[model samples]
Target: MVSLIRAIRDHTDEISCCAFSQSALVTGSADKTLRVYSTADFKEFPFSPLTGHGYGVHRCCFSSCGSYLLSCSTDGSIIVWSSETGELLSAVEHPGRSPLRVCALAPDSCLLLAGACDGTVALWDFPSKTLRRCAAASEASIVACSFSPCSQVFVTGCTHGDLKLWDDHISLLLAQKDAHDLGVTCCSFAPHFKIEDSCVELRLASCGQDSLLKIWIVSQREGTAWTMMLLHILTGQTAPVLSCAFSADGELVVSGSVDKSVTVYDANLGTLLHILKQHDRYVTAVALSPAFGLMATGSMDRSVNVWKIGDGYEETEAESQQAPCQGRKLPGHSRLLLADWTEEDVQSWLCEEGLDELVMIFKTNNIDGSEVNHMSKETVAELGIESVGLRGRLLRKIEALKAEQSGSEAPDEFLCPITRELMKDPVIAADGYSYERESIESWIRGKNKTSPMTNLPLRTTLLTPNRSLKMAITRWKSSQ
Candidate 1:
């Protein structure tokens, strides 16, 4: 479940863009200023409301390392600021003096790319703040731009429904005409890549006025321009998707739409997971945090909502190095591998699950832990249990047991109260208790509104990874 943690109404005008770094978040608005906030508490930066742009700021971006923030405005200039102090660092006036629509920073922090309303694409040496080249590459307004992970290639989308690929030298490589039906609004490259044989495989997401969200597979060989193939077309938004971005791990994707809604999708499955309807007007921009379970969505309603995302994929270090037959003990449980459990242990588990009558059936089949762990409904019925409800209850209890077996003989301080297991990727929640990442996420997903330890009301569901505690646990395990 996704919960809104905070709604910021700091912008006096409609928000134009919002971006998140590891420690800070920045939002640009038509009010001619940008606001910065500390990620720790979502507090405004001391030097926020960065004032210098003479006109409305249309787009903003943070460098890969979060040291510098860049914003382009109708004033025909790109202004750079120190993210830490909000001091004006440098500025670049557009060569054509055209209003910039979108901008992107290369992942390697070597270059900057900005697209203009006059169809010009400008490349600059970001470190030195020097203009490299400015070329008129399209007949229509350039609305979207993104750079490949390798920084050797980039893509730009225009109002004519064209998506063009380019090399670092401002040379056009490939052009896909009418990629979107109406116009392109936004595009983003997934931050991670894989090496397959001689080519690198990457994923990119783009949304447009066509009311469609697209996932594309981009492939590039050594010293070659990237080639793309359409992979998935996500269609959960009824209106045009104005903004889209992939999570840092590339496992999830999120988008905001003109429908006044935000949608999160499982990128790998192409499945829609949640629809958030908090904005009264069009949601214009969306950004996802790289480490923390945080998301920022900016809307035309003049607000930015910070949300807490539920994560279920975090794995603990202990689990990865677990032995098949590792020995440990829980307060009221045994930490034995399912494959090693005897028929007697299985019977005891059935009794604990309130399935005393099924003990005879399981005993007849010699169903040990291994067999029960792999049982399907069909297999359960084959055991002469004709009750459909009974089969479901048995299966659900097995899943609960799987969620419980954290590790054996772990310290009490390292165990999550809800799961009664050693912490795996521990995170601290609003109640100031550290828990296994997936355990608390599952707790919040089940609609529990109170702390598991204190039973008091939970002020927020935001979970920050407990790095210090995690390091201590790792060191203790190493000495064991």
Candidate 2:
């Protein structure tokens, strides 16, 4: 259930690239300008439209810490900016006056990598603001580039559809492969995984004009060399795939294509889950924010769409209801303490304590506090408690009554009508029923203009924010 939060319309031309920081978003455009917008309020910066590039800006990115921004353009220059104030810090001229189409920042924020139309990759050290290495990665133009999470290695995709791996510190080619039949558009390294005591598994995802997405497994070989093996070839997009990104947890892969659609896939299962067709034109970029369960897509139609994603549970009502469970008993002491307590008694306690919102949540979810003892602290936090102090107090109380219980289940109302998982940002639609914002939006805009739960035609697609419900959900989470 992914939906659009807002569609910014400032850029005169198509938005080529977009990057999100801790509190702000930076976007580059073919209009030859870069704009900074506050994530808090989605307001453009006062001194925005950073205008130093002589040509269209192709790519923009934020450093790992979100303290700096790097933007590259067709003018053959990369400009670094202070993310806090949107001030120009420095500019590095690209070699051979080639359009720098792709760029990457190391995880440590110590190095910057840029790939240009001249088929060369340039590495620069941030501290000294000097070029450290520049080498030709391909005879064709470099289209996409990404650094491994560890920052020790990087991968570059060229117009000829060649994928090349390189050592970060020095310009050294480690491995090369012909990945696609047509030009490669984007490439990204998956989060690292520890497979064995001495073995680590790394994966690379690349999408290209061939309308296919490929995953490659990179692993350390016997001594000092690394080996790459094709892991999977995902084919569903009708048009060329332009951009791809791995979810923060690395369990999901999302790609945008020229076919005016976005596809979400199960990374581990290698299966298609959803094909979201919201954009009217080519979807050029897609980004996932695991921390907030958000997905954003930028398109050539001059719009940016933000979607709400669930925790990989897109089951139908029947499937979720049929999910298996393992039963376990509560601790003896805990059972004795709650022997005389009832749902009404818990509601009374909440009322007396001025926790009216939490009482509403309990009532809505059909929770009696009896199941609170079964939830772990982490699970409670996921309920969306906004007050840290209140969460801590609830955690201590739950710890006193908790034991190893396996048959815990969430309330049916907590699940979204579309995703069948607990709603992260629920909203009341025209049907007068609560649904996850993204889920409902996807339904009304992408699918049928009817309610999934009621299967009734919606008079209007308008939705109202369920603030009180959200507060109650937060309280419920704290209790869990």
Candidate 3:
């Protein structure tokens, strides 16, 4: 019915990247410090911090075993750290000006691949402390990349609208395709979690500034042969999708966007199950916790948010766990791809005390005909003093506040375009663009208004309606 995990408060400045380990989460930010928070309590530790990057971190990942962490910065340096103590173990510099955006670790953990700003993929070997191989894929900046769980095969996408698969040697190209016309910001591999009708298959999903999510299938044939097919396409996100990821079971997918929301999709059918609005700004990153039930995300708003995903929303052990891997909870949630919600309505209710932190809980039945909930012990514990209280009393109060104020929504009071803060007045943008505060108020409560002061629902109003803005408004009005 509601999300148990909420943002208590932000401790960092513009969190750029985040990684989840069993013990804690390590966040790298524009502040140039890596902050680790205990997953057990969502509590801040003594703060074992790492410093050195002159710019914000771009990407970060932990070894499959969770022993070592890797972080790449806009400064062109990749730093390896000990996950346990937050100690910097090694730093390698890429020979380019742009940041390293994507990374992958081989199954053996001995080899690592870093995708850089110059549209090149560089390989590194651990303990050897040497660069192994480097290969160029595109002329544009590389924004997204990932490795197939099965083989040495990996894929990378660039800002110039290209996607290519590569061999383990990082040399020969396995396949290449222009997946999108706009800059591809995120790409991910679908897990082979279900064996219901296996015929040597894999899936890849990519999203970009084009506002589309396309699914591709990788099929195998005789003698290392492969075929990629476009299976399904999802179009609804208002802005560019920032991240896309698969659920543990490969049955579901999730994505985040510049539009400030996260959407969950059924990986196989491409059904949009949930659209969550929890962040005040663009959602920069999203990751499924190892437990398969919990999900975590980071945003430019400088906060880390966690969500519990399961029940009617996910496949349970009874429905999924059978025979060979029955007891083994598939390494992830079933058929789910983690890709990365609604606003408070203010017209009907007097005030919404904590409407911004609300989350929806989906309880799905499994193959075994049993129900499961993804809310973890840590997630329930993170519930605020008012939420996880006696007999859900505090929850009742919070719900009461949301319900009373939700139906009476107002837009202008909902958010300030400039600071991404709550708007306070009948404010006019500096460029002379002004909106009727009542239009915002009505839209927030799910009311449709014909003459909204703000023409673009997905974008902030430009202070000046220049030629470009005029063209955008024209196109928007035409579409409407």
lDDT tens per residue, model 1, 1-480: 676655677875678899988899999987789999987777898899899986667889898889999998765689989999999999988786766778888999899889976788999998897899999988777889999888988999987778888999999888878888798889888988889778888788999999999998888788987688899999999999999998888988999999989999999889999998867589999999878878899887778877777762232332222211122111114436666788877876675455767878988999987897788888888898988888899988888776666444456677665544568699999999998999788767645555655445589999999999899889878866
TM-score of each: 0.65, 0.63, 0.64
Where does model 3 exceed 4 Å of error? 1-4, 8-11, 96-98, 191-199, 311-480
lDDT of 3: 0.60
lDDT for each residue of candidate 3 in 134-238, tens digit (9 for 90 to 100) = 778777667788877774677888877788887778765555556788778888887452223444677898888887788888766545566678887887578
> Model 1 clash pairs?
none
lDDT of 2 at 462: 85
* Best-matching candidate per lDDT: 1
lDDT of 3 at 166: 79
Task: Please say which candidate is ahead in TM-score: 1 or 2.
Answer: 1
Q: How accurate locally, in lDDT, is each candidate?
A: 0.81, 0.73, 0.60
Can you rank all candidates by lDDT, best first? 1, 2, 3
Write candidate 2's Cα lDDT for 1-480 as tens digits.
543444465765666888777677777876678888776556788879798886668888888788888999765689999888879999997666556888888988888899987678999997677998888888777889999888878888987888888887545545465688787999988756556656656888899999999888877743557777888889979889999989878988999999988999888777998888756579998877535556767777666665557744233332222222101111122223443445654554344333445656666665565656455668667667678876776666555434322223345466564444567798999888898898677656543454554434678988999988788777777777
Superposed Cα deviation of residue 466, candidate 3 (Å): 22
